[model samples]
Target: VLTGFASRYAEPESQTITIVKDNLKAVPARDFNLGIEYGAVYTIKRPDSWEIIYNGTIVNSLHEPVPVKNLTLYFEDFDEFVEIATIDTDENSNFYFNYTKYGNIEQNPLVRIMYKGDGLYNPLDHIEYGGIEMGADQNWWFYDEDGDGWPEWPFTLYDLFAALQIESSPTTSDLSVYLAWMAEFNENSGTSTFDIVSNLEGLLKGNTSWTSGRRDSGLLFDGDGIITPPQSTGFVKSVQYKELVFSTSDVTKSIALDVGTNISNTIPFVTIKENVGDDWDDIMVDVYFTDSPATVYAQRSTSGATITVSIFIVEFDDVKVKVQSGTFSNTGTFAEETISQINTSKAIPMAYYKASGGDDDWDASMVTTDFTDTTTIRMERHGSSGTMSGHYYVFEAQDSEFSVQKAVLSMSSSQGYDTASINSVNMSKSFIVSSYESDRANDDPEDGALDVFLNSATEVRAERHSETSYFNGFPTINVFVITFTGAESVQRGDFTWANSDTFKETDITAVDLGSSMIKSGNMYGIMQSDGTGSSDVKSAFVQHEFVDTDTIRLERYTNNEDGKGHWEVIEWELMSSSPAVYEDFDYLLWNDILDNVFGNTSNQFVVTSWIYPTALTSNQSSNNVKNVFFSKDGMIEIGINESGYLELFLSTDLVQTTARYGIEGLIQTNEFTYIAIRYNESDVDIFIDDFWYRSAVGSIGEPWSGSVNITSGGDLIIGAELIKYSSFTGKLDDIS
Candidate 1:
């Protein structure tokens, strides 16, 4: 038996055949018996690309034949490894065919097998088999588990868990069996690299019964609002907490206190002690950053009497936070302004205020009323005394770590303590209290015992004692409470720090955040201010800001001689608990079918998609950072360029010539938009939502008129360039 090739037409012509092998001679096409056991024969059409006899089998995990019968066979051409054709398998779960090999015999052939399982078996993931020996047989065993073919089930507990597909949830009530999904954790690395989703739109309840005098705990969520097991902790870690005290008399309108801590990446909370000898009037006190390191500027609205204030600063190592700080100048009795920084709807907002401008600006009683819709702050300005211009800070509130509460309590007697309950306050945490008179009644100084303290975890008590007259009146107090927890994404700590004695800048290099995970919008911090010493309280001012991701630079606006320096910094960040849409290097790749999709013609064709873009530029390590959309390298690309222009690129021979058609400011980040790229035979038109930009007939030139050969070098890629790691950080849907 011999094997060779021949012409398809039966023509009477004399043909000379040459055989290179010495042992075997070429057989005539009519006399050659191409049939062999477990093999089949086919004609080789071209010299460069030829066909070979290939066979394979499908089986279950137990190596038994997949009894479901006919299955489709996908062939991946060796030239591009793209799915070339689909054939069928026989009843025995075996397939035999003459597979075409692209390029040459030096390049191995490949086969991609995929099975859409029947009712009794789960479907198989596409398995690509390559590097087949020239003469050896090829066989594959598919693990067909017993289940409906939707989400492929893991073969063992050690297998990486992906997703679960179900037609319906269990109907029986009080079912005891646990339905759990888990990812694999690498013991050596101490991390789980698998990505999966656990979503329950329905009610999720804990175990109903705990017999034997035991009780089962309900669901628990972490600081990121992610459901976690009871044993898990490491969400929020407290580094340290420090309370600093200082005195700022009316003669000293502003004082810079040093809390000898790295105030670079921290949030500061200040409360001034009530001036017992002063009259009922609006008091303004604020904490600010100075150029001085480890120092914060404390300021009141006016200067006349002596008063003491305490600064509470918290430093957090790992927390999710958002902070917005700016000065608001208002001449009216009330003002409501929108803050774009506080964008999330899930968390509350905590605001701090300090009067700015002239001493007259501090006369009117200005208070932070409420943060509504999480983005707008309402400030109630009473007492037509002066304009209220000051610095305001709004931070995303996480109740477990820190919170600020305001309450109005009136003292009926002049010498007793009147208590009011503060709802939802954790009883086990520490508190800092500051009070001020806000009646706008008079400016006459009245001597009385005015002090406030935490009577209990949920209640606060105040005392008022008058020596000459009954100075009994209602006063508003702002309470600052801080708690430390081991299960939130916050870091709190303190360090000894001092500012430049002679007004200069101090720098802290690489604030030890335990990790280099700091970004612009996710991290915020506040620090406390304490005078240089207990006796000397001098007027001081300081400012601090982040230089980069990890550095903080502080500058002192005023000179200081001697004062107490105790500082505390609180830092927090926001984390994503759900599965990420797309990471830096993640993308999607498709077969080289752009030629088929667009065809070899200058005809009007439209391509469109609904995209929710987190960013218009790529965040990966590649030279093609601007290609944050779709790309078929060397042929065509559609993405935002480095100049933020939404452009479509077409090239005939990319190494020699290319053309680009784009529009500026049409695409934006953090927005959902419908984008369409239309080529109307003559010119190109791009539509972002209802807005369209047309490059008329001769403006940006025409789309490539004929077939741009799709080569083996690259295929169509979504979310990134073909040969690099430039990936789009967003969600995409309905591409056509």
Candidate 2:
């Protein structure tokens, strides 16, 4: 009785099935699915350029072998390796192949599973649909029992293409993200068939949770005209006791003479204090000043009672001073007064001033009183009520003096910081106003600034610099400095600088000694006259440029005779005889060179010729640079030296071999003419004067050593070797 095992044809998608192979229960731990999204770690091999051996054998339900278009073969490592297997169907689809050298599963390489019409680059890997992505060469981080950042894996999957064939590449997001996304998408797709029908025309309102207000309150009322106060517990005076109503003028008016008042606005403001937000209804105010030393006071008003009042004079920002003028003529919207006039005479004036500029930025309008011209302008910032920020700039006057065309005030359209940025320059202060109007004078600029510039002077404050009042923008109080030269430049015309400062203004006299790293867009350059190194070149040096000069040069240097500098033929100009071109002996030289060709002393003679590379000699004293050229049958054979001489021995074996000759020199009948009289095998082929003379000579597969070393006065020439036995003479020359 014979029993056969078979697949459950009725349930093709079943995860597990009992198999009866020859009446035996067969199960391999679990069930395997041919087509499914599997998340299993695998041991994959590399797939290289190759042809598919076969798509897996297909079998029908009756156990008959068939063919299927499911087997995939891919080369994941480019030209590295390959995998060939078929999509086996039914009972026995296990793949097996014989291999001793190439195709084997043990050598895990890069492989990827191709799904989308066998296209390896299918987008389904990362698509919102099916199919999974694989790794290529990146080392994946796998977490296990120990801790995070552990690489404890069975194997490191190198390439994705190869890894997919045997095992799917592990990925981040674990199984959670995939499952979550899948579940979410499925739920969104539908709960039941009827739930979808109900919301078939669902409203596509924004899935947001924000509301402008409560519509219910507008629609329904509590039946009371006024909103009843919410239930609350009673509180003490500090947090809950509201301020008693009083007039603002009443508080500051009598409080100027009286000590203090019941209102708390007089508590005084902290330095850097921003006002508490506006809706306090109670009389509450906070001011922050850096230097004001005055105490604040609040007083109840006999002047008024409905409102509470508070007042504080921030004194530090408000300095009692006047402007002075120098080096400038008074003009429209411009005034100036001399230092003597401002200090001694107590007067201020707007003057047209001309200067190179100062350390801080200086606006032409604000410099009403300019006495001395500037060598270089940096500017003085007025952080407080002094001046506006970024509105002032030093000018490189094309003429003797730069004139203020207009006093432009930065308004709402203006950008950057509000108020003024005070620079740390030491100089006298002056005040002025812009002839033009800007909506955001005391406010911040649209563009933005590092910090808010407040006018430190007593005259201007936040509301005082209103767009309507100033017309343009706010004026600036500034400090200026006199330019000075350090000891950096005495005779060299180089700029005065200490080593610590990277930036310097210098005038190059003879040569440029600047650093190699030049700024990206600066016009920094050097000039040179004609020289032996490189010809005239007047251009800025860019990065990664190779500079070759006629005089100064940088080249590869080596101490040994061989393996010195890396040399390759750029273009071999074989025109050695050109008068304009001369060999400079810069070519490589061989060392300790010696070639024994055609030397005989006893019955048989042995000869050998080999190229002697000179440049790579370890022992300098024992090295000789050999330079020779060989020729064979109209072909100029290079680097083969031979001593002019030939010797033939009458061998016992009846072997027939002879030398050939022509008009140029010796000749041969075959390709390589290494003329060797042998009782054994092949050696050097003697090609004399561009013509093959004889076949190989000497011992078989060994160096030449017959009876030739007994006696002979052979001339060992550096260019060419000579054979003393036969008295043969050959010509050779050194390559210059």
Candidate 3:
């Protein structure tokens, strides 16, 4: 019977068996069968009960079927089986359970299966067999247990009780004790057992810190479990670093940055630190980006001493820039891009034209390309043929359109007679001409001629003439004519001169002939006639004096026919003369006498003269005042006194001996002397040649009670006082 039992129970049996495939498919098939036989007491052996069969190879952790052995399996059904089955896997790690006592097991019943580890296998509890239905709630259950909502297929014991739920026997007490231990173990393990699971969940949920061993399994992290990588905002996608330096001086400086070719926004952070001997006062630093002429990130006006500036540029997309530049030349064609890259179609090609060296007399014109095609521009010197070459700058216009209008001035010359014609557009013009002629013969019949003409369609003309004419013949006839073309013009003889034997006109008026001529003494010669055989030889002298406005006195003296041909006054009369001549003099002399001009003698008196003394009187008495100017009573005198010195004196009550001031040491001979005497009530001052010579302080009494007399009636002599006493023997001028 034992042999028969052995034959039936030799193979392990179980209600259910699970074969774990550790990520392997090429595994040999294995079978585990349990056979049990009763040897005593019972005459018949019960058939193997509750047989569980697993006919597959054991797999590795990857679930692939791998060739491994001694894999223990524990099978239990808490709701159905009163006994549990435990078996060891074969070389293939496959098992079977066969129990004759129990027929086919019910479906959907609670069960537990534990994998007892072997040399190649790590032990694990896989519970919940047939009766454990996968529900939506179970999805959440796995997520709660492992903090990852992903389902694990082929449920294990850990899924049900958080621990291995294998029992030695399928009994209520065993299951209770196992569950209690599992609960205690779960309490002890805390959340650490699901750390790997949580990490995997974090990887799928986009968490930051999930690590294994020494490396991160999910997101990169620091030692403090903080996220290392930047978050995504769907707009800003990246991070970058850049270093920039700006060297600046006292003047404004600019630095260009390499932010990138394409950018939307630019945020620049600048830190400026001044070096030694650097001045930061009133220094400005700015950073920005531009896309004109070229894409440039720039910093402007960072000025100080030696300074270091750090700039952080943040660049993005969606930002735009426009650049504009120009090339200029005065004598050559310049090549430049006239179109803007930012707004190529809207760009306006522009040009500037100016005289090469700032000349305003020449014409200049500016031209631009059509708005539709502004890629290039050509500017050429334009206008009148002689217009000067000009500087030109071509660029994209800042405004919508650009154009220029100009005027031209041209000059040409043609010579015939002595006239010049000028034509100009938008210009005011003027000119002048001069001609000279030699003296002509007295008898020559040719007449001097001058003509002027001016014509203009839109301008007004004015003319002026200055002329002078003279003749060497007597009874000469001269004629002048002028003509005008317009209807408002008056026709008249402009000038005429004639003389005949019957008229015998000896007085003549002067006229302008627009030329320089010779003058005879005080008269401008008009005409002359030579003596003939019938007429006695005659000669005349004419004199003219301008007396007042429009009036002149003329005196003519003719030679008498007494055979001696002596000149005699023939006519003396007054006539009209226009345009009086102006005379200028260099010096004035007092030749006319001043008699009794001073009505009375005062306490103060001054006598002055500029003179050149030539001689001195030898018989003059030293007690008498040899006066240059003497009053009637001898109360005032300006002359040499008793001391033989040039002096000015005032006597009291016409007493000659009471002379108050006899200024001495001022007598000059043969040299021009400026002598002056200033006498006040208390003092006298003498000046020689505009310099102070001597002075005396005292009471000077009033002299002449009557009017002050000078030269007293005898034509008031100048060189001689009263034509007898103290006559000046030298030239005297400017005496007062």
Candidate 4:
């Protein structure tokens, strides 16, 4: 025993020993083993700061390496998704002590800590610990069960370090994460050995939420929700273009809409702004031939003022109408004066027809798979709310035998309808409409069941009216640059060349060096002398430079532990720098997957920038397609840039691209803003806030359809091409 160590009794007796502290009881993450039934006491001093990370070592007494398959991490009795504190363990089977800063409260804020008895988590695991937060309120500040709050006595810093997760990469053996199971037994009881069942790792799987050791399963998470399953809706709408405008999106992570509001929050009819006085606000608008009141997230907003606008409607003599079977109620309103100011040339925008979200039909996806001249791919509509579903009223409508009608519905569901009566609907973009459903199959929700939601009819309708367009015009946001202070520069070591010069949002990480010329003014360039040349570079975009003192490095993460690290440069601008000059030429869609360096389906290389349009708002030239010259890797590729853009770079040399804007309902020459460029395995896709878009498979590389070779790596730059006649020239901002 150490000098100051002492228990309640003069010496700790092997017989049942009772340890008590100021009415407080807590448990630290531990390891229980069936090999040795012994427990050791770990004492920690209460911490001062409100936030603390308690670290320690929970080990199986034998102190030997245990087969990982035999280890199990789970919480108390709640066998399902155990939402317990989960962290990756370290090497040496040691728990590098580190817990959340949250305190254990006055009472015990814990449940059960268990392990597997048979050395496997499959069947069942032994309960190493079992308790909940329940103790006197007086001991709250002094007792730290999680060891994160005010630390207490008997707990030394080394004790905390022992409990932390230590991961090791053995030079000879395969790398692994280790957890040491250590337990103690009381001879007073007949139990001699403790099982490795509950190894302080909560449930391997979790409930609702996600934790490690759960379903990462092999699928890479792009953060963007899958909008469509990549199957066609079996319908197509075509729009010819003279000069297509394109916007580039972050070409990383395969462009999940969940990452951007453009995909996550698209709804029909809602505008981007409350009011615009004169200029026509670029809007993504959805329109229909029929006029009717819509139901959705409804609200009334007003600054206690009213604007006068005349409306014109033609009221037909009471026409025969059916109201829900036998119910009949004639509701009609008189037409008023018409407003002449609103642009009436392009009301309902035409959409470049393709298959995306929407469901319950054999439409596009199936039609592509089983193409038949006679088979008119069916269209489906999830009931009224617009939530998409595999099933549709149109699938129900197809059997009725009206070819044209079926064709029209199929086409409409694929993209949208177009009419010349109005203009500028593409500015609002597309939307997703969906109907919620249930885990079970009951049609209506059970009484007091607490689970009643919409059906699978969620159809995200893009181009909901640009709210600003409703006001007459949209306002252009002013652009400004953030200025840096010299005191900060001095604090940052006088902006020396070796010092990091980037002004990142986090001051703790970024440094400003005064060495390179690029470091002087904007401080934008970052160089790594440690970078690899021809035969030795580990990363396509990184240098080996680091603590070695003489090397400069631009690795994804300062340390390799990030597991998945990425580096990107961002340049934001109100407009693009692409040249405004034009040469008339016929162009079909173009794709390049041949030469660009690509990443896996999980982590991809990305680049994106934006620019305004060439034509004025009043001009009506055929600006259906914006010329785009983009290449993911070293090879050159050309294609049409629209309101939306998506590109994917995959590990293999394959590259993919996806676009939507400027094709269907887009007006001639509206400014294209907010561009993104990205790439990953499986496919690539792009988006422009409201309507712009793009999509392509990663396997198709540069000189698309001509090469199936694996893609490698290369640098990326805009406004100019790495080679040849294809390149972009436009105004840009936020260039990193």
Q: Which structure among the candidates has the greatest TM-score? A: 1
Question: Each prediction's TM-score against the native?
Answer: 0.32, 0.15, 0.17, 0.16
Worst window of 10 by summed lDDT in candidate 1:
214-223
Expressed as tens digits, the lDDT of each residue in 1-736 for candidate 2 is 3347644445356577765422111111112332212221222222431221111232334544432244343333333545443332344532222211235332223333222322222221111101111211112112233433111232212111122343322233242221111000112221111111112121111111111111100000011112233332211011101112234333332222123222221112111101111111111121111213322332211222232222222111112221111222222233322233112112111211122211112122123122222221122222212222211112111221111111112324232223433333111122221211222222221111111111332221121212232233343322121111111111111111121222223222221111111111101111111111111011111111112211111111111111100000001011112122212111111221221212122233223221222221111110111122211111111232122223232211222222212222233211222222222232223323222334434333222323123222222222221111111112211111
After superposing candidate 4, which stretches have Cα over 4 Å from the reference? 1-603, 615-626, 629-672, 690-710, 713-717, 720-724, 727-729
Ranking under TM-score, best-scoring first?
A: 1, 3, 4, 2
Where is model 2 more than 4 Å wrong at Cα? 1-94, 97-186, 189-327, 330-736
lDDT of 1 by residue, 489-516 (tens): 3211222224334222233334434321
Residue 490 lDDT, candidate 4, scale 0-100: 13
Ranking by lDDT: 1, 3, 4, 2
- Alpha-carbon deviation at 563 in model 4, angstroms: 92
Runs of candidate 3 exceeding 4 Å displacement: 1-326, 330-345, 351-355, 365-374, 380-736
Full-model lDDT, candidate 1? 0.39
Which is the better candidate, 1 or 3, if ranked by lDDT?
Answer: 1
Q: What lDDT tens digits, residue by residue, belong to model 3 across residues 1-736? A: 2674474435666797777533322122421111111110001112433323322345665655444434333334445534355555555455444323254344333334455555445565444332113211111111222423212221222222222343332233333432211111111211221111111110111111222211112111110112233322211212222334345444333444443433334333332333221111212233334554213232332243343333333332221212333443434222233444323322222222222322111112111222234454444332222222212222221232211111111111111122223333121111111111212222121111121222231221211111212221111111101111111111111111122221122322331211101111101111122222212111111222222322323222222211110111111011122432212111111222223332233444455444455555542323354535322233444555434366444443333342434344455555555455555553445555423434332453333334232222223222333322343444444333
Candidate 2, poorest ten consecutive residues by summed lDDT: 563-572
- Stretches > 4 Å off in candidate 1: 1-266, 271-326, 330-333, 339-376, 396-406, 412-417, 423-426, 430-437, 440-450, 464-473, 478-736
Error of 3 at 647 (Å): 99
